[model samples]
Target: MSEPLPWYKHFWPWFIVVLLLGVIIKSLVALNIAIDNADSLVSDDYYKEGKAINMDLRKIKQAKNLGMQFLVKVEEHQLIITQHGGPQYKAALQVSFIHPTLEDKDFNVNATADGTGAYRIALSNAITGPWNVRLEGFDNSWRIQQRVVINDDVEYWLN
Candidate 1:
C-alpha cells in the first residue's frame, strides 16, 4: 500500500495559504496603526483645549455662517432672535435688538426654550439696517451679543 501524505509534507499549499494570510494580517495591522496614529495626532483633549482657548471660535465660525445646525437663523424680511445654551438656562430667554442709528428704541422679545437649549423669536414687523442682538442666559449668566444685518430681500433658510 502507498503511504499517505503527511501534513508537514504539504509544502506548496501550506506555504501559499500561510503567505496569503500573513500578507492580509500585515496589511490590516498597518492600516490599524495608521488610523491609531492619525487619531492620536489630534486627540479629543487637544480639540477641547483648542476650543477652550478660543471662546469665540465656535460662536463665530459656526454661528456666523448660515445653515448651521445648532445656531438659529433669522428669516428674511423678518427679524428673529434666538437664545441657546445648557440645562440651567431653562427658565427664561431674553433677546434685545437695537439699531445703532436708533439708540433709544430697542426691539425686545422674550424667547421660550423648548428644553433643547434652543429658542426662537420672530418679529411681526420687518426691520432693517445694522443691528445688535444681545442674548442673556438665566442660569449660567452667559451673555453673547451678535451683530447682524437684515436686508429687505432674500429669504433666509437654515439647513
Candidate 2:
C-alpha cells in the first residue's frame, strides 16, 4: 500500500488555499482602488449652501413669473441658445456646463444676445457623459436649470 500523502501535497487543500488567497487579493485591490479614487461631491461650506437654497428658489420663482423658457442646442462645438420668452434684450447670459463628477471639467461661457432672442457661444472643448446645465441672467434675476446626457449632439428645451 502507498503511504498517506502529506496535507500540503493534497490537491483539495491546495485548491481551497489558492481560491481563498485569490479572493483576499482581489478584495484588497478593490479596497485600494476605492480609497485612491475618492470622489466627494459635497461642498465644504454645506451650511452656507443649504442657506442659499432659498435664494435659488426665489430666482426660479422669478423665472417662472417672467415666463422664461429656453431652447438649447449643441452642434459640433457650438452652443446655440434661444430664449422663447424672457427679457426683450438681455445684455449677457451666463451659461454654465457643470460636470457631475469632475469639478475641474465644469466651465462657464458668457453669451451675448443678438438683436433677436438668440444667443450663440463657441465651446472650446467637447464634453461627454452627463452634465447639468444652468442658465441665468447676468444679474441673477432669473435662472433655469436642465440636465442633459450628451453623447454626440443634443437639443432640448428648458422651461
Candidate 3:
C-alpha cells in the first residue's frame, strides 16, 4: 500500500459516480428524443381521418335494401340509385366514383328519378380496376355518406 486515500484526494470514487450519472443522463435524453420523433411522424387529424374511412367501409358492406346490383358496364355503367323512405325528396342525390390508381380523376353522375324516390345514373368508361362507391344523402340536419369498395375479385353479400 503506497498511501491511504484522503477526503479530497480520492479520485476513483468520484470518477465512478460521474460515470454512472453520465450513463443515466444519456439514456434519458435518448428516450425523450425517440418519443418526440414518433409524434412528428404522423398528425392527429390524419389519424382520425383514416379511422373515418374504416368506419365507412364497414357500414357500406352491412347496408340492406338499396337497389338492384347491375353490371357497371364501361360503355354504359348504369347506377340505379333508389331512395327508400317516406314522402317525396326535394334534394338531388349525388353519385361519385373514385379510382384506386388515379385518385384525382373524379366522375360525377346525376341521378335520374324514376317515381317513388327512385333514381338512376349512367357513367361511361369511368375506371377499370377496383373502386370505392360513395353514397351521400341528407336527413334533416344530419349528412349521411356511405362508402363501398367494388373489386373484381372480392364478393360481398349480406349473410
Question: Highest lDDT: which candidate?
Answer: 2
- Candidate 1 Cα misplacement greater than 4 A, ranges: 1-70, 76-89, 115-117, 152-159
TM-scores of the candidates are: 0.41, 0.72, 0.38
Candidate 1's TM-score: 0.41
Sorted on TM-score, highest at the top, how do the candidates line up? 2, 1, 3
What clash pairs does model 3 have?
none
User: How many clashes show up per model?
Assistant: 0, 0, 0
**Which residue pairs show collisions in model 2?**
none
lDDT of 1 at 2: 100
Maximum-TM-score candidate: 2
Scored against the true structure, residue 108 in model 3 reaches a CA lDDT of 62
Q: Tens digit of lDDT per residue, candidate 1, span 1-159?
A: 999999878888899989999999999999999886663233557877877647645444433342222244556444433333333345665667777665555777777766555575656676766777666444423455667665665333322
Worst 10 residues of 1 by lDDT: 62-71
Whole-model Cα lDDT of every candidate shown, in order: 0.58, 0.85, 0.52
**Residue-by-residue lDDT tens digits, candidate 3, 92-138:** 65556766455456676655567655566655643445565554433
lDDT for position 23 in model 3: 100
